[model samples]
Target chain A: MTQTPVTDSAVNPQVAAAPVAVDVPMMRLHVKILRFNPETDKKAHWVTYDMEAQPGDRMVDVLNEIKWYKETGLAFRRSCQHGICGSDAMLINGRNRLACKTLVRDVAKDGGTVTVEPIRGLKVEKDLLVDMEPFFDAYRAIMPYFIHPTPFPAKEQYQSEANAEKMAHSSNCILCACCTTSCPIFWVNGSYIGPAALVQAHRFIFDTRDEAKQQRLGVVNQNTGVWRCRTAYNCTEACPRGIPITQLIEEVKREVMFGQS
Target chain B: MYKGREGQWAFLLHRISGLAILVYLLLHVFSIGSMIFGEPFYMKIHNTYDFVLFRLGLVAVVAAVVYHAFNGLRIILMDFTSIGVSVQRQAWYGVLGITALATLYALIKLIPRIAGGY
Candidate 1:
């Protein structure tokens, strides 16, 4: 990657000249990955793979090296190879993060070890692959799509900037389940609908054009809904999209309590 | 990874302090309620609590109660206020600061009493 050095003689005549294109030095990183094969192995185990990685190499690149060069049997879920797909969310060093987005330098401690595991609170199917059905089920339960039950007008339903701004961050969620899987509450109670579902509900609940605010709010207002969130803020921290999930859930809680819709 | 910051610790400490208060409450009721069994029983119960370990436990309980009470208010503020969620970490430090001050105050008042054995 081409990077302008912080100190360059071009900018400051007194300073020594620095290279315009500075290549990131490669460092050896020991990746300890949680491995599980439901058919062969009754339990999960850790397998460490030592490899050289550039500072800016993504976690997915590290996993790809293990799967392609070291061990051909290594398995993982990755599609877009970018953060947008949200298919590669995993537990990186104890936090839920998109594997494709997290750089090796940021996660690796002084060129030491980086632990990779399937996101918790879900069934592991194989190495680095967790069953995402439960995560998606919660997402589906929130009625994620826009719903306007009544007949629509002839023209487009234009939304105001203020109204759109309210649901802007919530809509950015890619259903990654990073927030939901990282939640301690969801780790034990799988039916709590989790933060992903709540964010989805928030997106619809706050939309000015959607008529299903009460319907959507009612779904999230159950005993296992917004009230279950203990304001741990783990969801807020675990969100790969940087969505303020805990605040959204709290807003939903207030709506449920006061019937604000 | 599990490197949770101030918010995580705040939640964990809040839960722990709340449970500590509950345990202390149960012990308090049982010990104080020993008065029903007459003077000898009440005296025995009170004397046992005077032990150094038990005295230390009482101080810890005071700290717990203070932390729990202040953190509970922080949680309530986070639930209702517009700026509370944004500035939650600062509010948590405030909660911890108040708890520390209250615990220090308790220590100042109780140390002399414990030392004098009165």
Candidate 2:
């Protein structure tokens, strides 16, 4: 493998003027990727690969490299290479992280093993791909959209900045299921409304513009609803968007406990 | 491997221990209620707590109470104060340590009593 200085982005020409005149250093990263096939394998197995890489490559890029040169059977989900898409969220090392966002260098700047696996609590359809229907089911149950009690105004209705800021952080959620799937509560009990759905519920619930507050509250207060959450904080740590998910759940719970007082 | 976070384990223990304690409380209340009969009849009741296994169960109940109470305090402090989420793991370790020490002291005091008599 060639370790040519990866000037993939040559915008900063000043970089080329550095006359150190040395071969680009090589990094060997041992990637232990979990593999499973429903048709054949009875259980999942770890497939570790020792490969050369640039320090700047993201974990997704490493997967791509493996798929490009080594294994054709590897599978995962990604669309936007940026963090916004939230498709490539997986258990990196131990915690959930978007493969597209986690730089390999950040994982191991000195080059070491990085384990990759599908997020827990979801059925793995193939390799890294998991059935997202369960996650979406919870999302759909929350009616993840704006609601209005009255007829539409002819013009836009204004909302105060403070009111808008209440739903601000939760509104940034990408529905990646990272926060929800990482939760131990949701992991063991699929009936529980997971963090992502609650976050989505929270997004519309606190919206001053939305008129379905009571309906939303009723839905989340069910037996398999927000009450199941134990404030574990896993969702907050796992969110790629860095939303304070446990706090949002708490806010909704508070609203439920003492309505509009 | 799924290496669980500290909060997850603590929450699990809190729930399990809470359930066990509830069971113990209900049974104790039932036994006390059974004392409404005559004194001789009440004295004829089984000495369940006199057994070694019963003593062990009591120790477990004591341990659970210690852990749940201390962890509850840790959680309360975090809620009321500006304590950041970063120290959560350390806080868990500290509370667990205190729980262990307290449980050990309770066992030391209770063991001799059980050995002596009913």
DockQ for each candidate? 0.40, 0.33
True contacts kept of each: 0.53, 0.25
What TM-score is obtained for chain B in each of the predicted models?
0.92, 0.83
lDDT of 1 by residue, A104-216 (tens): 88988545999999998998899888899988888888888878779999999999999999999999999888988888778889888899999999999888898888888
TM-score of 2: 0.81
Residue A46 lDDT in candidate 1: 96
Q: Which candidate achieves the best DockQ against the true structure?
A: 1
Residue B79 displacement (Å), model 1: 0.7
CAPRI-style class, candidate 1: acceptable
Predicted structure 2: clash tally: 0
User: How would you encode candidate 2's per-residue C-alpha lDDT over A1-261 as one tens digit per residue?
Assistant: 214345722634432422232455657989999999889999999999888766666788778767755787788998887988888989998889999888887777556898899999999999899999999999999999888869989998989999999999989999888888888888889889799999888898899889888898899989888888786888887888889887788778777777643
Off by over 4 Å in 2: A1-24, A109-111, B22-57, B70-98, B111-118
